[model samples]
Target: MSTDTSTAAAAGTQPGGGTAVQGHPGRLKPRASRPRRGPASYATVSAVAVFVLAFLAPFLIILVNAFKTSADYRSHGTLSLPSSWNWGILQDVWQRVDFTQKLLNSVETSLGVVVIAVVLALFNGYALGIGRIRWRTAFLVFFLGVNVLPQEGLVYPVYYLFKELGLYDSKLGYTLLVGVTYSAFGTYLLSSVYASFPRELIEAASLDGAGRWTILWRVILPMSWPTLSVMCIFFFVWSWNEFLYPLVLLISNENQTVPLGLAGMQGQYTSDPTAMSAAALLGVIPMVVFFLLFQRSLTRGLTAGAVK
Candidate 1:
């Protein structure tokens, strides 16, 4: 056998090789792997660029015109930059819309929703995901079903309920409703995050004589910051842009949010393009600033579930 192998090597032939393609023994060459797919085609790249520009064009136009005087906006065209910058446009808008009070309302209500939703999600997730609770699947599904049921379906009922509870047209009512509306989704997200937590750490914490809440607040929460942060961003954005609840439940200008304020501005200045543009840009500023700030945490939270 040894002689045969040595002879095959010397002859540059193997049992698997043809005479024309002979190779040394024990040096059988491996087949090449399929080549990696290259980047997207030019047409694909062009289409994506067109889509991005199409999305950004209107936003950029709005942003630029927001700084223009009404005269410039009318004369220069909607897509063009302001002929001369007017920083006062934002201030004028602030006065026109009573922007300070409305802005305060938005901050209060948005934070209210965030705190209520995320806190509930944390406790609820700890219970259903990490606790020894029974029929948690049923509970989860019920919450999901409740969440998927459209707010439009419950609008009148919720309105009447809030009215009866003396919470109608109040920030608390808006916060509670909006927070509860999204809380189910938050709970669903947090449950998945909690369930996959290291069981050994939990067991070790349990052995350390920590109370249930203590274990959750100290051990689980520190580890759960990424998920919690992402939920905060999600809930804040949702609450910030929430139109229906504020539109329906909040009647007074003082209680209305940025979106509702914009709607009012739209009615008041249906012809003032520059003012409207400024209002539109200002409405979304908080959301943009918020997402930019927590973007890293949001990214980490999103990818957390992908691994285990």
Candidate 2:
């Protein structure tokens, strides 16, 4: 027993070393050290903060200048605060923008595009990805073609076609055009979701006498919600922020979207810089709110797609 005690002490073992040490049996161990964020880590953080501030500066300038009087803005520059806080300019800008009419037009048109695009995507993705559709490769190629073809190349023809149909200045025509244009993108995105679908589950469902429609409605849709949410976020942002289409197509205030209405702040000779800034600031608020609300959905959708 005395020899054993002497041996344990010489070996740097615990006093009651009957079993074994975790890392090296019968030996004492060093305590684990926590990792410290060094200069490299702090440099990365500093770089990120600088990048964020660079992007945020323009938004801050816009917000600050939006409240100033036109003269004050022109004199003091974008970075300076207003001498007199004219809070009522927003109310004036709101009316000038035809807020109610423009807002309604934007929402309706975006919703129309979303509905049309989502429906087209769902049906086409189902047929090509899951159904026994003939010439599936051809369908895939066609979808890819539509997406790759630059809208600029076909603008003249599309405009002529719409002109013949008396849809040159109509919101409905614009909605259909935008929807069809974006549907190709949506179909391609959703095809990936359908392609990765569980084959065994589909076979089992079929064996249970469940039809394709039932399988799609019950299984595919529920599983594909994350992808759908991602699509909605993209399509919504695109539709809301569309400028060129609405600019050319919407000729009047009654039918013009928010972007077009905001553009009206500029006159050929003189423009209200402050009012334009105010309108632009107001226009961005809804989209910002929307992104904030759906940020979690967007994150989850992206992560899910990445993992798959």
- lDDT, model 2, position 273: 76
lDDT of 2 by residue, 30-51 (tens): 5567999999999999999999
Report lDDT per candidate: 0.84, 0.85
lDDT of 2 at 248: 73
Q: Pick the candidate with the highest lDDT.
A: 2
Give the worst 10-residue stretch by lDDT in candidate 1.
17-26
lDDT of 1 by residue, 126-209 (tens): 998899489989989988898789778888998899989999889888889889878888888778777777899988988999
TM-score of 1: 0.81
TM-score of 2: 0.88
Enumerate residue pairs that collide in model 1: none
